[model samples]
Target: MPVERSRRLESYNLADYDRLPQCTNRRRLAAGIATIGPAIAEPIGRRANDRLPFPPSTPVGNIVLKLHQESSGALNTITSYGDGYVAINLERHEGSIIVMPEGAVIEWPVSSFEALAPEHFEALVAAAPEVVIFGSGSRLRFPHPRLTAQLAKHRIGVETMDFGAACRTYNILMSEGRRVAAALLIEA
Candidate 1:
């Protein structure tokens, strides 16, 4: 019995799991990644953000660009995100702004995450989209949840994400004919 146990132990290393490379299931891993590959590229839905390298960006000058869908004639889509600016509907905009398909581009005066005031969220009530995508700059920084109380009263939903992610998510939601609004903070 001791000898059989010894042989079994020799077949598997004590640190087998710890010694794993970036990918463990070599053959199956490739197939699995391929399965969710498209989702990893541009994840959709409210809870589909499983991948980290989302809305891949290319750097230009001080901007990091991630272009989403194209506009269907008058329908708006986020064309790209550049460093401290974003291009929507082939037009480049600097600073923060609120975007909606077939709606006027409303410029927001927010500068950075720390500058986010409750009134900032309060102001979005007028836009009145079913859902609001809050792009908290280049990285994901959640605002104080309480700030959205007013919007919540009107039964609006808010999803916060990075600038690039928000751009992609906005297009994804818009394409599905959902009432979506994107409030992007592009300065920092």
Candidate 2:
């Protein structure tokens, strides 16, 4: 409804126009476009149909991959997530993983917070992310202080959340160009 916050799409075809509410700012649409819905009569703006859709990889079970846009030396974004996996840049990986900005996805062999060991965190220390998103499966859980003490000594911060929040936060931080990592546990 807000004119300033309309989703700027790369390509808005007749089918796309057919899906919108009539009260929307139809005047903001590109010129020369066909009538989309019964209410859409004329085109509105210029060069609105020349955009390309970003293929954010969606998760399919445990392993899947798709084409994604280059991050321009940025860290990978979490495309989507589900009960047992998070899709990173069109690639769906299972179990636990260490996702870093500027590119490195180290598969961590962890299933749950109860299965975490000090050495599991040691891998993160070696990865040396400035901030870590520790996703404790489907629920909120925290690791032992000793497990993360070494990272604390290095001034590295770790935020604990559920798996879903971890995925979203990871994407936001990566887009911001932050030195962040996601240690996600997507199992019971």
Candidate 3:
């Protein structure tokens, strides 16, 4: 009779009572306990196995640029070309720019270029672009007096260059149609 009903359900005592835990037994107990309380809970189970979370920020819109060619080492790699092109990976300690646009990925933290006053040039002239390059990564500087009087009171037309001539003049004025937008500062 099914081996005496599996030896009477394995001799039955299943810890007497307190049941409700099995989601695969709470994934083998070792993530974020919900039960197993008290009894010196082993220093709260060794500080919940030494805490570990942050790893979920990476979602914006079409993006793909991965070029970490051992400039020092640590940018892992992920290249296959997506839309535009601003791929440069050099890490001996740090250097990253992979804004691949096609599905998702926006990692922009260029290393050396910081001079945007006038409340960051009036919030980049209220994000109403028509032309606003400004790589200044490789260095050329010039944009302070209240961000040149708020881009001359919203006449928005600033093009301070360097980061590879401001990424080739914002990709040739976005390929001759114009409506450009770039604010780089790469080199870490």
Per residue, candidate 1 scores C-alpha lDDT tens digits across 1-188 of 45544333224454664455632444453443465566646647544444423333533333354558654677788888868988888899998999998787888889888988889888889878999999998889888878878888999999999989999999899887888999999774
What is residue 2's positional error in candidate 3, in angstroms?
75
Provide C-alpha RMSD values for all models, in order.
16.9, 12.7, 19.5
C-alpha lDDT of residue 63 in model 2: 22
Compared with the true structure, what per-residue lDDT tens digits does model 3 show for residues 51-166? 42211222212222122433323322222212233443322212334221122223444444452345544555655667677665555886655655776677777778766677
Candidate 2, residues 96-140, lDDT tens digits: the string is 888886666778888767778888887877777879999988889
Positional deviation of residue 11's Cα in model 2 after best superposition, in angstroms: 32
Q: Which residue runs of candidate 1 sit more than 4 Å off their true CA positions?
A: 1-71
lDDT score at residue 55, model 3, on the 0-100 scale: 17
* CA lDDT, every model vs. true structure: 0.78, 0.72, 0.47
TM-score of 3: 0.22
* Of 1 and 3, the candidate ranking higher by lDDT: 1
> What lDDT is reached at residue 33 by model 2?
23
Residue 12 shift from truth in candidate 2, angstroms: 33
Candidate 2: the clashing residue pairs are: 10-51, 29-45, 30-45, 31-45, 57-90, 75-102
Ranking by TM-score: 2, 1, 3
